[model samples]
Target: MYLGIDIGTSGVKAAVIDEQDRSVAEAAAPLAVSRPRPQWAEQRPQDWWRAVELTLDALAADSPAAMAAVKAIGLSGQMLGVTLLDRADRPLRPALLWNDGRAGAECRELERRFHDFTERVGCRPMPGFPAPKLLWLARHEPAALDRACRVLLAKDYVRLCLTGEAASDRADSSATLLMDTAGGDWDDALLAACGIARTMMPRLVDSAEIAGIVRAELAARWRLPAGTPVAGGGGDNMCAGIGVGAVRSGDAYIGLGTSGVYFVANDRFIPSRFAGMHTHRHAVAALYCQQAVVLSAGASLAWVGGLLRAPDLSSLMAEVEAAELIPAETPVFTPYLGGERTPHDDPTLTATFSGLTHETSPLALVQAVMEGVAMALADGHEALIESGARVGEVRLTGGGARSTLWARLVAAALGIPLRLQPHAQTGPALGAARLARQSVGGPLIAASGSEAIIVPVEPSLREQLLQKRALFRRHLHLSR
Candidate 1:
């Protein structure tokens, strides 16, 4: 059996799979973020470790033999967060998360410092990325920087705690803006641009390479075999792609979690200069992928649910699906609660609900939020196509994928058949498991091909959706 662990923004997940790619057991532990200030998201590194422990304990309770038989471990997590460690591998401060927008000024300074930076890094310096976050720390939290002995990504930090090794994979490092994405290594010039040193970085490795082994103490504590090899693993998004068999060229998937993304794989490195798309190395070695992101997807929905005093997201979504449209008077929502990335790298952007009136019902407002996210995702899909990405179909994954209404909205907006995986919600953790299996010469599972229950475009909603999408864009521009 192979073990795959994904440390996500809101939780930590673990899964055990057999050689045939059958899931033997799976478990997850929920996590909470500390938003002490607006535009800033922080998490305690210890919480990730604790969550991992809880997940492992649950897995052990489910099937101790499967946990013990784990031959290799693979890890995946949220990308672009900075976890500063002291000499003793303790966190210096709360990790700056991928959604944290406190590095906007630093991103601008980075652009001013480096010429042709986007060409080198395959992306512009956005606030959520790690490099600018590090720069922000250097300026605002110099004490933390001075005391730091290593800088690790979210998964790498977990790896250090598990294996006593400090290492990172290319797929995660590619988004740091501290590495040459095309060259697949740290760039000294880029490090200097961020006022950081190369030594601060962990050793880089391939996603499938053996990064380290579970330490004797932790292994004994968790009933895991000592010295069991752990693969370098990948960023959660890349692993999610791998989980759904999106390894080959043009294979793509969309994630609708706290953030939203349209990801497509390619064999060669291709960076966009003006479109604001992100080009990074794939979890699969020698392959690359391009992505367009929506900073807030389900997050916007959650915010609205809280505002309307909805008991939970599921009930809220049900209300949204049943809600009748106002017909030519429906409002448009811009799901930029955490700013945006693709096509607009503005970190200061905030969300808005336009066209709201006394006549608008709570259900209409909920529908606007869902449709807004769909339109945002549609814009990303179109941007990917404009950049020459050949997308046949899209696989929807994440918590948001649970809603039929949202899927239909996205399908109509993007005008593509959207597929839902059997393990759509757990694709990242499953992909992490697949990576662990692949590292040990396991059979490569083919992409879970087209499902019969695809969310196809609704003829009646097509023209109305087009108009709403246009209005969404206009609202985005007006908000900016």
Candidate 2:
């Protein structure tokens, strides 16, 4: 038996899985974020450690019988967050999240400095990446930066707190936009561009390799075996890719969380000419993935529900469903309420709602949020497919995938089948658990008996949604 932990923006989830890939027990603890300033998202690394503790404690309590059987632990976490630590291993400052845009100017500087080595490094400059956040720290928080002795991604930080060792793996490192996409190592030119040296980074390893064991003090505190192995896990997306049988090259997946990411796995490096998406090495050796991000996904629905004062998502979604309108029926909405990340990648763009009339109902607002998110993901799918990646049928995960209404709309608009993995949730943890099983057992990835089916929708509504999406794109610039 082993444990798999996933540290996400929303929460930390822990699952205890047997060698047979059966999840015997599971636990989770929610997390919250703080926005001290607009366009900046920060989370205390301590909160994650606590979440991990609570989850593990709950699991241990639920079934004390599994405790002695536990052998290894695997981790998966949000990507591109920067957590700085002092010489004594204390957090130097709040973590800068993947969604933050404070490093835009720094990203431009990096592009200028490394124009010649862009392709070799595996990425172009982006304000949302980890290295840019480091540059931002160097410029604005130099004092904190100077005092910081080590830098870790969100999951690695939690790992250090448990194991007393600072380390990272390739999958999360690639998200920093600092690695050689082809070679699976840090790019020297990217280092020069960021004015950072290799020493500043943690030792890199494969995702399933043993990172370290839980330290004696922490193990004692948690009442666990001191030498329990902790394996290096990759970013949530890649690990989630592992959770599904998408470990092989050319396998693709679509994840819908607060934001959405469309992923396609590969055995070789693939870079995007446009900055709309990211290319990275997979936790699995010689594998890579192209991931396109949509800035607002389930968040759009949450916002709509709050704005309409709906008590729950069902109520809001029901309202949206009741007022279904065609392109000829109502108006247009550019769903840039949150700064866009995919095809547009525009920070200055704000969401726009056109065609609102005196007859507009709260239902219309709800529908816009739903349809807007669908449109955003549709645009991402188009860009990813256009980039020459073989996007097979979609595999949907996250809160949005639970919407039968949404699944039909997205499938129709994209003209592809959307397969939902059986356990619509905890895909990453399942992936990590599989990786752990492989560490002692056999293969690095596996597919369970999870099943999915294609959703059905009226053909006319599908065409109408597609046409409305086109109209939204046209107005995106004309309104600008």
Against the reference, the lDDT scores of all candidates come to 0.85, 0.77
Best lDDT among the predictions, by candidate number: 1
Badly placed stretches (over 4 Å) of model 1 are 323-329, 446-452
Q: Write the per-residue lDDT of candidate 2 for residues 38-150, one digit (tens) a residue.
A: 67878999999999989988877776778657778888898889988888888988898877767878877877766644586556667678877888888888898888778
| Leading candidate by TM-score | 1
Looking at candidate 1, the ten consecutive residues that score lowest on lDDT are: 443-452
- For model 2, the stretches where C-alpha displacement exceeds 4 angstroms are 220-226, 318-331, 446-450, 456-458, 478-480
lDDT of 1: 0.85
lDDT for 467 (candidate 1)? 78
Clashes of each: 0, 0
- CA RMSD (A), model 2: 2.3
Clashing pairs in 1: none
Q: Which pairs clash in the backbone of model 2?
A: none
